[model samples]
Target chain A: MVLRVLRSMIGLLLFVQVSVASAVLDIEIIGAGEHQIPIAIVPFGGDDLLAKTINAVVMGDLQRSGLFRPVDLAGKAPHELSEVSYPDWQARGADALVIGSVALQANGRIEARFRLLDVVKQAELSGQAVSANGDQVRAVGHRVADLIYEKLTGDKGVFGTRIAYVNRQGKKFSLIVADSDGYNEQTVLAQNEPIMSPAWSPDGSHLAYVSFETGHAVVYVQSLYTNQRTVLADFHGSNSAPAWSPDGKQMAVVLTRDGSSQIYLVRPDGSGLRRITFSGVIDTEPNFSPDGQSLLFTSDRGGTAQIYSVPAGGGTEQRVTFGEGNNFSPRYSPDGKGFVYTHFINGKFYIAVQDIQNGQVEILTAGGWEKKPSFAPNGKLILFASEARGRGILATVSSDGRVQQHMFTQSGDAREPVWGPHL
Target chain B: MKKLVICVLLVNLLAACASEKPKEVAAAAPETPAAKETVAAEPAAVAVDPLNDPANILAKRSVYFPFDVSAVQDADKPIVLAHGKYLNEHPSRKIRVEGNCDERGSNEYNLALGQRRAESVKKMLVLGGAKASQIETVSYGEEKPKATGHDEASWSQNRRSDIKY
Candidate 1:
């Protein structure tokens, strides 16, 4: 009877010690405010090649969001959960920590096990294991981002998507597809004439762009895999600014064979040539809304350059922009919440966003001459053109005005970038 | 007879004095700014009819080139002189220039070509005596077909520059 009583007392003492350790862990993190939930990514444990690759990718993903600042692991590493000194983490200002290890398991399979902790809540957020080889190290890193994103943003993350853009090298123009990080660039079309606009089809299997190969701007849709190309329209006038429909069956472009520069719609098979607008002035640069209900474009019918929207089937157009200077290139957000456009006023151009409801213009950047704004698939990042010093370069900003990333084509000039659909 | 001869001489001297006095009065008058303004506004106004309502209500402004070239036209001498005179006289009148194409090219190419046309006009207004700040230009390209049908008569109308008040 006495032994049983002593055993229960010992168990209670052990529980108390564990609770005390957790309390210390919570108190040691920085800015783990009421809103800022803490997480922990423990030092990656593995050998040189595998460890270096995984750690670098994981760190790169977290740092890009601008919402996350990674904690460095050094020789003062704790041997186990018991040896994890809460005071040291508190000094380092880590609200949370992730302890993970990567190694080869049975059957020649590589496995990575990761554990998440809410240092302040004194609880575990998540502990997960993902199986992948070295070839998939980059993808696994994205999965880690997804895991962290859901915990922090309360929304699923889409980090697996790609971006396609027009790259100009010397006098040569090419349609280049690359990973969003500006890596693994692949050329789909290499042509001498300038490629104006490159838009991804709804299914992402094909791309539609304007090429000046035939001495006039013509819309051509081509499959990325097989390189099968078809000219959508090479009409009598300007066949320019091709925007794909949500279903990818038809494309909208600007043609003036009738009288003036007016917007027209053509099928993927180049059968129908229907006029969508008769502005009696210039109307071009049409972009389809994600739901395919309306088309937005830049028109001078409003007395000056302004953005206007018309139904996809054609109807009364409404003025969407009402600022002093001219606005061009209205690319709607994937979620249909807002749009990004090139705002020109005061002898300068900057990217501005106009909410579909209030029509309020929010200037996304200042001082830089920005044009051809494209939204990231997640609707959290914006890519646009910024001229730095003497030349033009590509720049990005997070939707919330937090993150900014510089991207470019090594081929010289990377212009008119459109982030592909969520992968 | 001697008295009659003296009377005739006196009448002849009086006529000579009257003619010389009027000639001297005309020579003494200085050229007024209004005269200069009228002189300046006349040539531009003569280029287009004033009663054409919208077209000539404000003398139809145009972008000028030295010869027949599509390059951003430079106002050699006369157009600038006319634009300056009109601006100085009609200070409150805001002028808008609508550029046109001769219907020789496709619609999109003509639009760009017409824009270059209007830009030439804007540059002239700025360089000429007119205030660079007051003028605005729009390129109708080949859309506002000034003339219907496919002949030179229609093409001439299509290539014209209109002055809008």
Candidate 2:
């Protein structure tokens, strides 16, 4: 009874978190990168409100990454290189500084010019002008942050990328696509049925997902541009786990029509169907390798659910995970060196990654209701589903297992989160 | 709605008991008018459909299973068999078996497991003389739950297959 009362209290708290304008997510970050770069971002010079909005986005992105530490401005605001006092930043212990200015162009486009400087060297590292429409202030900010991140870390930034997940509230379900920071949520589909396993196409133009609108599990491919959807797989039994190939020409889907759940490949236009895995058992959740030559899937043919790999052209299957616990939802890294999956052990679900060569497994999150892990396009972070305070939320852990973040939606339980490809 | 039905059934049972007491009290009186009324109501009482009768096994539609196991256990065999026999006798009624799972595994894995569970019950129904054409199976996986708790008490109830007509 006390637990029930506590859950109701949490429900009330979550209800109050909902805003009137849009469905905003509350993000809580934990841990930090090994080496933190102390950087300072000064507000842009022109368009005060727009500049503040963009600066907030850039600052939030950099801080949430767990890599950069925000250096206190202390009333020091410089919007251009000529106005910056190098010795002032140096004295403030800032290794790097970012200064920018925003202006509304006559063509109604907003342009922001940013510069990243090295305090120690007393030299400019990189400078670029990013422009977007007035309404896309966040996009402009993300672009600026990405440029700064790439300049400093030598790794691609995922600030401009998108993610898709299912938001379930009672009997209502919605397939939502949102910005990487959990902003700008757009509902692709909403209905009074369950939706699961949303897989983004390699090009990010479409999403293939499983829906129960037809009274059973069926796969559908819907284009984000036109909002047109077609049945990709509507077999007699359950059709689910639609995974797109790297080339975007075909997809692998799990179907139970031919007997037990088996993996099958078919074209995106719902033609050229070919059965792939002959495992007459529960062989599902097929994910394509980066090279598109193999598929990593979960199967129970070995008496327990484990990660297995089979050639894309249909060949001998090899077990990829072993010992201790059952693993599910195996997704290959962009580098194709290892794979991340859900590791279930002792009645707990953990997000774990296994190396293909050494067979070494690294547990990322401190085990909870974490499941269906997929890597970011840059292979720097892994996103998955997690439960907090009796609600399902989206969570991510860095590849090194050092940084972690939890994103709570405004309402409903978020599940089946998949990071979109690099745009 | 189910509780309403049970309440109505209980009231009718009590009224029948109250009416029967008067008949039993006058057992020594031969050819009583109350005995004639009882004889008249016997056929109507026997005419209730077994599927609608709470006392019959056919009224029970759900078959429960252990975690990760799809086979119909001995405890639920009679329920499945009773439905199977009823279908075979009627030859017109059809049922859809929906399988569900506890929130333990990945959604996709649980989906396949639930499908296997539904198919297992369908196979048993077919073996018990129900035609394959009379049965259709689907899996809701861990999406729908009969219980909302996270403990074994709830998980046990969630891992089940319901026969819906």
Candidate 3:
């Protein structure tokens, strides 16, 4: 009977897979912590299949975080709170222990209950239960992971957030949205021409991106829920680089219709055109600050590409980056303290973050064609695009540069990653 | 005016042939008439259209630029000037200048750089006598590449401004 239930649950999960046979992005960690938290997640007992699935997910999430090291249980797992032997976990050098159980309710739903324990104190830190259908098991797992992460780190977990990126397979390009862990990937928009620079709306309901379907680069805003898209900036010349303001009321775009490419702000519905940057040289790639008072963008007016900031209402520009290397694609962090940008130096590109207050710079990733660094809503991880094995892949590094992870697709290149807002 | 000058030259040669025909008729009349007719048609068939001629500078449509540079080079200026002259002569003709860039750096910044490349060419065309209204400029940025390789050889070709009539 348990085997039958397991088969049915797996079948339901398979049915929920995206239409394309897209292999989930395989993640490889590098430069993880030297002193990781030693934790043990005992296998849950009831409804064996569901419990195992949830346990694996929670364990995987914590391990991928590079902060926790799950101890080898060797098949000895206690499911109930009373069954947990604190001495066993302490003997195994575990600082924390997680135990959970799943049971099939009478209404055909699965009820998952979990307890997070502090092995040192031999006391239960937190306990919770969640109910979900077979189709929602994966979501419940992510939620459980989120709860565990929050309880451990004192920060809200980003496991439940989504990411949007541009995937290139040969001549075809697609805008894909996937779970924060790179699972359940769905192609939101696919076309033969290039689709790039996907910026999620502040509310995470829509995406503003550049599409070349009309034979030239044009900006469009599309609703994720309704699949409806409106042409935001299809000017006479190239209309590219659409960035959303914090209020979601306006978008800043790069247009060449008026002689040279300049940054312009337009309403989401394509009205109220206002020019922002007045540089005669290239001024593009505009991103709004968290407060929407200033705009950060790349400009070559000083002869080399550098990041500059101008008031959102259009005013004198202030150079933000100064150094030997060129800086581009600046994105403001969630806290608005500083921004992360792609810096080119010594023939290689690296992701670097700058402090707005002190003008100090911290180089995050090592180097190599890294572009489009975006901060996760939690501001813990910075997602960017880098080449791996000669193919473009999405990668993330902890903001502190302690942990690094690379997410690779099976057959194509994935670039231009943007973390969606917390929904 | 060049076409009209060729037409006038052809007419003058025809008149000279006609005037000489009477004297030729005194020697051999039938052959002289056919020869005159052939001579009258020869120049018209051989006259070349400057725009379509391979030797004309206007035939060169692309202007290449150095890496990260949008200023039109001295060598490519003549090609732009030739097109400018042609556009000036044919006031009704319209041309579009499309700028492109090599695939490097930020894509949006490339768009602005490509536009600068195209506008630089457009500015020269205007200076060389073409009206601003007769010229339209657009930048494909790094999106449209003439060559797809990752090396300098391909990038040099990709960084260009193409004039299309």
List the DockQ of the predictions in order.
0.02, 0.67, 0.41
Give the TM-score comparing model 1 with the true structure, all chains together.
0.64
True contacts kept of each: 0.00, 0.85, 0.61
Error of 2 at A226 (Å): 0.2
| lDDT for position A324 in model 3 | 98
In order, the first chain's TM-score in every candidate is 0.81, 0.94, 0.92
Query: What pairs collide in candidate 3?
Result: none
Show where candidate 3 strays beyond 4 Å. Answer: A1-21, A43-56, A103-111, A131-133, B1-60, B86-96, B127-135
Pairing residues by index, what is the TM-score of model 3?
0.84
lDDT of 2 by residue, A103-206 (tens): 98899877898899999899999888877666667778877888788899999888878899999999999988887888878788889999999999997878
Better of 2 and 3 by lDDT: 2
By DockQ rank, best first, the candidates go 2, 3, 1
Which scores better on DockQ, 1 or 2?
2
Write candidate 3's Cα lDDT for B24-90 as tens digits.
1122111112334344443322244446644344557899999899989865665676577668768
For DockQ, the strongest prediction is 2
**A142-246 in candidate 3: lDDT tens per residue?**
778877888988877777678889888778888888777777677788889878789999988888999979766789998876678899998777888999999
Error of 3 at B84 (Å): 3.5
Candidate 1 displacement at residue A316 in angstroms: 0.3
Q: What C-alpha lDDT, on a 0 to 100 scale, does residue A85 get in candidate 2? A: 93
lDDT of 1 by residue, A35-138 (tens): 33333456557644555566655655555555677665555544245556666666777777766667776665456666666666556677776655444454
